[model samples]
Target chain A: MGLDNVTVKPHEKLATALAPELTAVNTLIRERMASKHAPRIPEVTAHLVEAGGKRLRPMLTLAAAKACGYDGPYHIHLAATVEFIHTATLLHDDVVDESAKRRGRPTANLLWDNKSSVLVGDYLFARSFQLMTECNSMQVMHILSGASATIAEGEVLQLTAAQDLATDEAIYLQVVRGKTAALFSAATKVGGVIAGADPKIVQALHDYGDALGVSFQIVDDLLDYEGTGETGKNVGDDFRERKLTLPVIKAVAKADDAERAFWVKTIEKGKQDDGDLEHAIALLKKHDALTETRVEALDWAEKAKAALTSLPDTDIRQMLSEIADYVVARLR
Target chain B: MGLDNVTVKPHEKLATALAPELTAVNTLIRERMASKHAPRIPEVTAHLVEAGGKRLRPMLTLAAAKACGYDGPYHIHLAATVEFIHTATLLHDDVVDESAKRRGRPTANLLWDNKSSVLVGDYLFARSFQLMTECNSMQVMHILSGASATIAEGEVLQLTAAQDLATDEAIYLQVVRGKTAALFSAATKVGGVIAGADPKIVQALHDYGDALGVSFQIVDDLLDYEGTGETGKNVGDDFRERKLTLPVIKAVAKADDAERAFWVKTIEKGKQDDGDLEHAIALLKKHDALTETRVEALDWAEKAKAALTSLPDTDIRQMLSEIADYVVARLR
Candidate 1:
């Protein structure tokens, strides 16, 4: 998985192909994150933005635009805008999740305080809005702003849904779309829209991003339950947090009266004992929830690849398609 | 200040003059704040937005647009946008300040949790951005977005500066402009921009809002020290929180060595015993900081009125000018 390996990861390959634009996006991010009056703005944002998080969302923006024959400088602005939105969400998410660590490092909230995280996150959101306006396209602004609304709405929805026994797959999908897929779809759709791509092509880019994001999130949830020790995520962290992820939701749905009582106590009542995690895992296995979740993630990844078929067959597009497939490949 | 009183407050008078537009703005606010997916959004927002905070900022938008002879329907949207921004900031502010009360009610963070407050605040912010984009003016978007950035930057600055005794009047002014004046100026400027008013008229509106907001905040800080029990803000709340308002800043500037040590012990170290707040107030009087601060507020109010003289001499304009005077009149 290293950069020099022959079988380099899809996201790294995409980053290599979009190197110059990625550089421009990084420069723009550095320049924009600086505040003339508040030195803390850069300090808080730098912890997350400069952390090596693969820059996947922004690269998708650059890749989507380049695949649609966009040669203008605005794509750089859009890429940086996407990253700013991403970083802003991450900052707020840490505060919401009360997270102590992000990207395997101490989170901004831990380093400064929840106050800095909340306010600096706001500063990034404002910065993102300002950057999008630079593109001078109302259509782009419309899509990004709409995406922002959906993202926040999804998060609020998840807050209620994550602790409820009544939450089914449909509600889970809504939460996933709001928290994850909205930005992904917006990132890709705005790229094509800015490139003056045909409506159909832009629609295809949006579909690809949406499916890929869903697949990415499902796999992330799955990995938390099915850790290989290489992913850096502590297994059963979500369970300890009482968050009803896809696997737990599925297992609960298939639970009998006694198993339902277990879930009710552990999740809803939050009265789990030491062996409860082990019992939860056993129940997930008994119902084959992990396998079913993997199948769904793979299906979404396939849909993501299929949507990109209508895009130009450039190297960037090829890497994007592979990136979608790779998103769920870890499930194997 | 009651509606039927002939001596109705200036804001109430302005509200009477713009009743139809204000009604429309409320409708837009209610309509936009309700979320189809996240019921928590409306729940959390209604607790604050409907908590009777006077709607001063949105009223300014309506007044600015109507005074510029604009009869467009978009002012409703602009006014709603302003309120949404204000409400969103309040939501976040409560969480950042760890406040339990806002507008004489338990904060959303108290009723629900910090997570709900953070996410719902984000939703309102995103919703405001979407509402502004509907106005279809690049200039309006630029101004509002820039204000959002400034508001956040000022908040971050205040986070660091509030406890630092070295913070001067210049820094306090910058913080006030960011947290209050930025939105006020943007609210009024966008009204003029949406109305197709001349550049000079727009500048006047900007100036009026800027001065009014500064005066509004200065008087607010003054009330914290000279509380008549009518302001609803707890006297010595700012002192207890170690917030460095204008009077304290002035007093610190004129402090002797022992006075400086008292400020450092209370504000910098957050160590205070009984009568510390009383001593702080006494020091403020000893330095004549309260009188000086009151004079500055009156000066800003005068400037606010002076700026509005360039606009149309309508009843709405007269009410707006009166509102400016009434802001600082509480000091008398």
Candidate 2:
């Protein structure tokens, strides 16, 4: 139960450590998000970009690049690129999820319309591509663009998989990697790649980011069950949305006949009543699915830490390693 | 007024003229759209990509490249990249417009869902970026990425300006350029760039595409009033949707106080009544807006034709010139 090993401040330490670079990244983001003719670009993007995201992905980029000994200005560009991509995804995800709130504030889709969210998300994605190209490394472009494709693919897969009981851990991992870890790994990997690090070290960075993102998403899914975090909703938000997260997948896999019918009614048929969320949580508890999922997350966090061993023992690297552990530390 | 000047079959002649390149571009699109994990990608992409779009943007890439005397393999990739960008835009546009029909059938959003369309559009856009990167030309990426941003920015601008009474020709031109001409110009310019054409000639191709795209969109807006030519919607969709196209902008600019109130009631307030569309049409007719719009389209088409003269005289160039006039000729 000791908390000595974990760093509660995930992006906080990274932000302080990468202060100058983070400032440059923020400046770059503001400059790029501006539109001369269409003022709505900045308005919609500002709504989400200025909202209190931890700037975790962009920090990971800055940390990864700086820790690998890159001092060039392009790392700032890459960091901003990652942030733009993250914001774009959040905008589109809000629209797709019909989410009224994000970061405990009204979403752009709710404020302007779904149209603004969709188009502005696109503008940001296009902006991200422009930023990555500023790095002038085709290798970086390839990695980030590949990650962008995977992120969209992951989201589309989630759309279908979320409503199906046939989804399993394997499918869940793919979705998680696509929607979450692909960017994390790419964000970190491109950092090293842009820094011209060794292939093995870059691979190690990728592995670290992948594991961290997986653990982070697993904890997020778990938090939704334990009552929402910043999602600004009740516990079982995923259940209310009928998403097939790890805990429910495990629960459904082990459900009795009666429980199977309950899941079919709630998840498949989407006929949930007030008590359905309570009963769903009970079934997950009955199967110990939440506990198992937490253990898996911890395992991934350990892998993330292990991967960082290939990098130099810099302060930023140390922070990144601890951040991975903290990502899942909330689950415990 | 002679039918001999306008090739009744625009794409047919262009397709026959650019047969080999078109085949290769289609192959590249199919190859790139295939998802290793998500089957939904190709499913949704194919639903839109294969939905009979005339492949005009890609064809411009092919025609511009081939006409510039370049035999490079990357032109095919560039062509495919343009098509993917175009398809992606259409997908998102359908979702934004809540359009039930596109290309003479149900839109991808209608067949699948807004979620699929949004995610798949993101996928194709990413794929377009990926394909552009494979060309290993940062300049090409720069142009295409800029086009993508303009396209999205234009759409966002349209969302806000569509119902606003103050929207005028300048805003309408900006929107048209963003939503249509940016891609067309980028498609053509990249082709010439990839071919290592002369700087002036590359500029010429961009100019040609810009003009052609403007003329095409004007004709499209006109056809919506001249009774909907294959736009897959009934006449007055822009009126129904309150879209401030060029014709409507022209009419609004010339509106009297009483006419302004009619527009405000129908467009600004969405209090449309029966015969409002007919009254709107009569107002446009009375203002001579449709005729002036036709004159503007012809002027752009003429500009398009003039730009093509910079390129070497080849069959493809001739076809491109013909296509420009053909685009606006529909209105006449």
Candidate 3:
């Protein structure tokens, strides 16, 4: 009945292992988020930064750095940089998605306005670039900046791809990578780069983060159809929003004549009515879309773990391997 | 009249002097604004980039570099970076301002949507950072990134300061610097740094840009109140929008009890009746606020010209000096 009997999540375990560096990252984030002239910047940033998410992306940076046997203050800066980028994207994403709730609270956009969200988000992105520059590594600057471009490009792609019925698996992958994986991979890759790890090891870390991000996103999308209210998202939220995620894309790919018209009405034209969620789920299940998506998620999770085999057999590596498993374990 | 009899604008002179480099910058801008996966990126960006604005900020970068005898190719990169950052900010600014028109054309926010504007602006920012990194100068990176943060901070400050009666000359200056002068100064300062100019010369270049930017913005604010038709902005647009530009701030500062109530009702409370613009202008003239604002703008322009005395007296420098004069010349 004690803590020993409970199953601690891999992220929690990783957080525990890297608590000291994580604290430094948080401290740096607080310091950097403050604006001497603009109190609104800090106020809006604090709403998102102090929101109690897992800080998983920054932890990936810390974990990657520690796994590569690096000891440096700059890793904390890089970790904070990753978190800032993630938080900034979250702020903008809420505006772009017109989301009202994030992490179970009113979004910054809702609390303030879209203007605050946009400007404060720009502040954070600029702050993130400032953080990365303090690392003084050209390679790091290139990777992080390149990742920023990819992230923005991906977001623009998602905006265009959102309701289109013709969006395929390749576009879905690109959008997912843009919205989620670009930062994830950049987060992990910059950690290794700052550590001066071997190029192969750096690539491996990147691959790990990329696969883990794709798997994590796919699982989250799948949960939109399959979950019973555990993931902070209601079932069929994506369907209600007329989003074309992987499962829906697969379902659409296999749709017959009658099914195509139904999807075109609901997804393409966004003309949903009562029981559309149920019918969408029925079609997804009928085409085995959810099952196939889950299988793909599992494969990506495996690939994440496989990528980690290139690293040294340290405790951090073991924790990372387990985190990959934990990512897909949500589907169970 | 013969071409020689015409009063060629100083910016046109600078453009004629730096045509090849401007061409290179234009070429580079077109190349980098492209996104491999998202055609929307180019479509949205081209709408703004090709919209035939003056391209003043990037020209400052090119002018500064060429004035310093920087024969290298990277100034084109730096100039393009400045333009990209400027364009990015404009896109986001239109969204924040909810502007329908920019440069006498429909803004990207209106042409596409706020979502496209926000995301495409971000892409350009990222692309700007990437372009700066290609210069391989850490000093350039630091200066540019720091300016980016300042620009964002200034914008957030402006947001919180808008419509507030307490916003004074100091806050107005800070906001002006943030919204306009930060990037201008950065564009010029980085050109000097990249040219390996002496620290004194670099400092002077920064001051020149800073003062020029401050003056340029004050004139713009003044134009909103005074322009008949030449400036593209309708007179009293700022007052209509309830924007606390320099004139309003100065006028508010000198307000008597009745005038104070007028400002409180119109600017702060956003309750305006017919003839408010006429009354507002009367208050500005009665209190000499517009005159004072124009004087300060002239003073800043003088300071901008004075700062350039430290640089090598090249033809580009002479054009830059005239450019400073031309910035305020519109007031006459």
TM-score of each: 0.97, 0.98, 0.97
lDDT digits (tens) for residues A81-136 of candidate 1:
99999999999999998888776788899999999999999999999999999999
| lDDT on C-alpha atoms for all candidate structures | 0.91, 0.89, 0.90
Chain B TM-score (model 2 vs. true structure):
0.96
Arrange candidates, best lDDT first.
1, 3, 2
Docking class of 2: high
Predictions' DockQ, in order: 0.92, 0.89, 0.87
lDDT tens string, model 3, A35-136? 999999889999989988899999999999999999988999999999998998989988998888887789999999999999999999999999999999
- Model 1 ranges off by over 4 Å: A1-6, B1-6
Q: How much TM-score does chain B earn in each model?
A: 0.96, 0.96, 0.96
Best by DockQ: 1
Angstrom error at residue A185, model 1: 0.4
* Superposition error at B51 for model 3 (Å): 1.0
Which candidate achieves the best TM-score against the true structure?
2
Estimate, for each residue in B82-125, the C-alpha lDDT of model 3 and write its tens digit.
Answer: 99999999999999988878877888999899999999999999
How many residue pairs of model 2 clash at the backbone?
0
Over A233-289, each residue of candidate 2 has an lDDT whose tens digit, in order, gives 446768988999999999999999999999999999899998889899899999999
| lDDT per residue (tens digit) for residues B1-332 in model 1 | 31233355788888888899999899989999999999999999998988888999999999999898898899899999999999999999999888887766788999999999999999999999999999999999999999999999999999999889888899999999999999999989998999999999999999999999999999999999998766777788788889999999999999999999999999999999999999999999999999999999989988998999889889888888888878877675
TM-score of chain A of 3: 0.96
